[model samples]
Target: MQEPTLLILTALADEPRHGYGLIQEIEAISAGRYRMRTGTLYGALDRLLSQQLIAVEREEVVDGRARRFYTLTGQGRAALAAEAERLRSVAAEAERRLHVLRPGLQGGAA
Candidate 1:
């Protein structure tokens, strides 16, 4: 999966969030490394909805504007879990190789 897609799924992992809320949560999750534009976010939301990875949890009007809250589907949760495991495996192998290359190195010290 793409980094943005992964980040989006992760942001939705804990709880439902509206578009703006997802944006804020994704920024926090990436430690400010990524800031999704509104257009990009909505586009991704549309794609995810079509893929059944996420669904609109609810919709309501606030201050005369309609806001949609999104939640992850079971398929999305499973996909996220699998991707996390794959990342962990890759990281572990990299760490092991690093240790072999530098016996005294610890914790990614350069």
Candidate 2:
């Protein structure tokens, strides 16, 4: 999965969120490195919804406006778990290779 998709799934894994809430959470998750635009976020959300990876958990009325909250489906959780494991495995392999290449490297750093 793409980083944005992975980040979205990871964010929703904790709790359902509305669009603005999702944007805020994702920014926090990326440590402000990622600032998602409204159109991009909605596009990703639409794709995920159509793929059945995420579902509308609920809708709320905030200031007389409806806000949809999205949550990860069972399949989404499984996919996220798999992706996280894959990332960990790749990182470990990269570290191993780095150590082999640089004998004096300490814990994956020169």
Candidate 3:
């Protein structure tokens, strides 16, 4: 539901990724707007894991460091879908209100 959680879920929607990979994908998805730190990222990952929203797909040792790949579970996918729909609804409402408040705002030059 939160922005970080949404971004994390959305990032995993495409494919499984480790911590660094998730960070890159999330930054890409957000157009470099949200750069997550290591601490924040792992905290969210741990919470998501505890909530059963995501699961570890595999773990590999690279350069003597363990990299854990995570994937979205079925429930995670469902939750993401629901959140997307909710966002669409909210955006639509905002657009409609803006159209009313500022005439010619919709489908016209600002």
Best by TM-score: 1
Better of 2 and 3 by lDDT: 3
RMSD of each: 3.4, 3.2, 3.4
* Per-model lDDT: 0.93, 0.92, 0.95
What total of clashing residue pairs does each candidate reach?
0, 0, 0
Off by over 4 Å in 1: 102-110
Q: How many angstroms is residue 33 displaced in model 3 relative to the true structure, after the best TM-score fit?
A: 1.5
Residue-wise C-alpha lDDT for candidate 2, range 1-91, written one tens digit per residue? 8888988998899989999999999999999999889999999999999999999999989989889999999999999999999999999
Clashes of 3: 0
Query: In model 2, where do residues sit more than 4 Å from their true spots?
Result: 101-110
lDDT of 1 by residue, 26-93 (tens): 99999999999999999999999999999999999888988999999999999999999999999999
* C-alpha TM-scores of all predictions: 0.88, 0.87, 0.84
Cα error of candidate 3 at position 20, Å: 0.3
Better of 1 and 2 by lDDT: 1
